[model samples]
Target: MKKLIKKNIVIATHEYATGFPQHLRSYLSDHSSGNVLYIHHPLHPELREGIGSGYEWNSGKKRISSRSTRPVTAFGIAFFMKSLFLDIWWTLKSGKRWDAYIGVNNLNALAGVVLQKFGMVKKSIYYTVDFIPHRFSNTFLNAMYLWIDKLCVKQCDETWILSPRIREGRHRVLHIPSSYDRKQIEVPEGIWLSRIKQAPFSSVSPHTGVFVGVLLERMGLQLVLQAMPKILKKIPDFRLIVIGKGAYEHELKRLITQLGIQKSVECKGYVEKFSDVEKIVARCAVGFAPYTTEKSGLTYFADPAKTKTYLGCSVPVVMTNMFHNACDIE
Candidate 1:
């Protein structure tokens, strides 16, 4: 009898709870019969538990601590070093050579690059989900980040960008070097499509609006809040439902109280399950993706999972012009 070989695959990512990483995990778990090892920097403490064959490094605390400018740059350096050390440690401890190593961001991709160079991993894949030039407040640090990103893209066997806008705008315009031909760089239509539940389209009440995903400053929940009074003028019974949590939660709540629109908005906090989020969104009249254009360059190119989730629930989206899909809404 011939023995079946299980290819060893390693995935290193800074985010695990939501967005691309979560969908990637689900897809790999379902489709691949190989032994998959997930090395993730847990953004949420609750998601520290390993998924599939996985390991967690508490990258969340570092991010939370690095609120200031200097500390943010320091955190980036620390993250790169920590990820590299963890990758080396895992490679040594596992005793099995990795057939492939997939990195979700520049920091994690640095680790994959080193692993591939050392012959610990046969192939490397750099997944570019977001491209923000000024991610770090310090100019030097931001330049360093860009250099690292370029190196990751150049060294990796395959590069996968989330949106066509990014592939066209950043990759083509910036002229990043790649190993493979056109087939090497792939732009997937939707990362979360497999996990999305197919349900009948249900019309929502005109006065209700729903916003789902991470409640960050760039997400433009504040814009939604500011527009609430105007929306109320047109539709007196307008109510907005916010489902997610982030650093901007306190500010959002404060704004709600200050605007005297507390009764008109409901902050659902973080829903543990995506199914629950879908349930809440399904009852709303329109889905909101009011991302701020000035906040980040990545916003213009990002294929936000929240948009997909909203559409999956059959909710009409009211997003800003920054998003690539926003043009298609009309």
Candidate 2:
């Protein structure tokens, strides 16, 4: 008889509701043969289930949970208890008997290390998309996050980092740089690649610029807005189309009006389909990744999805010097 693969794998991630986990799972499912279970808390179980796909990561709860912003609030306590219980449950359920396990992100990696305490599994891989503890918080929080990351690095058999900068201080740890997914990284199969080969987004004027990605504060929207007047002075027809949405949408819009550049700046908001992203990017001549400089270690190791998407579409980019993933282009 031909040898049969009997490994039971678990994929732990926080991106159960997003495309990151979906794409990663799709790749894993194609390559591996065994029982592969995804552990995640589905915030929108109803909608996810209605889609008739196993992509749902619901914790079997009818009501979705939220975190309170107050200092030492009851909601914070409840949230931790709930999250801890879920983690313990998954650990016990997937531990011991499984042949291999993989965890994505720092939080999930910590959970995998904890699961190893049960003395069941031998191989556990930790994959980090970016530096976590330094991403959004202040000094104290960053220190605490670094402590947790140390524990994860010490426990895992192999660690996959997304950027070279992240491998510092942990040289002995087994590290792999996660490359852009080949399947999702391919150019569109149609006239666009040919058009790009000919003139590269002929629909857009040579001066027009476009940015696609989550419109969050860390992305340095303020800098891009500040740079607008400078760019406009050089190129009169210079226009910027902002895609994606977040907390600062209205504030950014107001800043455009304050700067009196409303006509030249357009905030197109969030997009649902990959094709929509391709279409929006196809209408621009230049792409921009204007991440701000901060002490945050997270920004130093970012592999912005927008960076790869723009490159795949054959659009040239102007990115921050501090951005790690776009160094080749820089």
Candidate 3:
């Protein structure tokens, strides 16, 4: 039998509405035992008011003490600079050298590579949670993003991708060669039910459809909402449920009102618990993920969590194949 070895791992990443870093933190705690350091960066620095420090550090149940930064009021370029500074500064002061530094996005991953230069980490893992050819509308910004992506790919000891299709993008689009190891795609773990409980609702109809996750326009939920009228005509009492909220909420509500299909649609804006989401999806007939393939969107290359969530519930998904892990889901 092979002897099991343990190593301390450090994870540096931003926290978005999706709560990806939190999920990852939980997963690591449950699966591994070395001294794991999780650094939480500000999601929106521009919104964080006046000298407040959004940068935080945690290892298991213990919190590391650090002074907060006067968050930059300006977003975009300024925010990127802030994120880079925080990533390096905190890791440098974290007291112990990490065996592996896992950075979730390209920017954070680039920070890990830099730390490897300063001898702070033995291995730097560029863990890409999302990928897209044209991530920014601005040509220069998009080019810069790709440049950093490639830099991280080459500098990091290993690149941990969520989907294999990301390799295709790296080769054909970003031009990274195939010689690099193509293993280590962390397929999301299976769900472990905390408690056997039904969704708060009475009973969901078989004709009902559900969409869950951060409500982004790129998700293509509008397409389903626009077509709900035609769907109701044929299927009778066919209803569609929107189970999250985002910047698109107002637009969704406006369109629902305009289409006069308000009666057939239920917008259940952001249910807080994962168990609640699980229960709701399990009872639904189908899950919608009609991603907007017309343009460059993060979902095109990221292994979407909702797809797994739906399948976990035994609910079939209706999604775009442009996604990186779409084939696996199929």
By lDDT, who's the top model here?
3
Q: List model 1 lDDT by residue over 97-202, tens digit each.
A: 7888888887777788888888888988888888786778898988888888778777888778876666565555457644334534655445354444544445
Q: Note the residue pairs that clash in candidate 1.
A: none
User: What's the residue-level lDDT of 186 in candidate 3?
Assistant: 51
Candidate with better TM-score, 1 vs 3 = 3
lDDT of 3 by residue, 1-330 (tens): 011125677778875444456665666665555566776665544333353334445454455554566655666686777788878888887778888888888999989989999999998988888778988989999999999999888888878777666777788888787676453455442444443354433565689899997676888899999888889889978988888777777888999999999888988875757777888888888999888885355776677778877776778899888776677788
Residue-pair clashes, model 3: 1
| CA displacement after TM-score superposition, residue 111 of candidate 3 (Å) | 0.9
| lDDT score of residue 275 within candidate 3 | 75
Q: Which stretches of candidate 2 lie over 4 Å from their true place?
A: 1-7, 16-20, 29-32, 41-81, 91-96, 119-122, 132-143, 169-207, 233-237
TM-score of each: 0.81, 0.69, 0.83
Each prediction's whole-model lDDT (CA): 0.69, 0.58, 0.74
Give lDDT for model 1.
0.69
Looking at candidate 2, the ten consecutive residues that score lowest on lDDT are 181-190
For candidate 2, the per-residue lDDT at 249 reads: 72
Over 1-330, each residue of candidate 2 has an lDDT whose tens digit, in order, gives 011133555666643223455554554555545555666543222222322111222122221222222222232335434544555465575433555556676666676777667665556767766664334457775665576666676677767666655664234222322322221111111122432322344565677778876556778877888888888998878888887766667788888999999999878765656567776776678888888776454566655667666666767888887666455766
Off by over 4 Å in 3: 1-6, 18-20, 42-74, 181-205, 234-236, 324-328
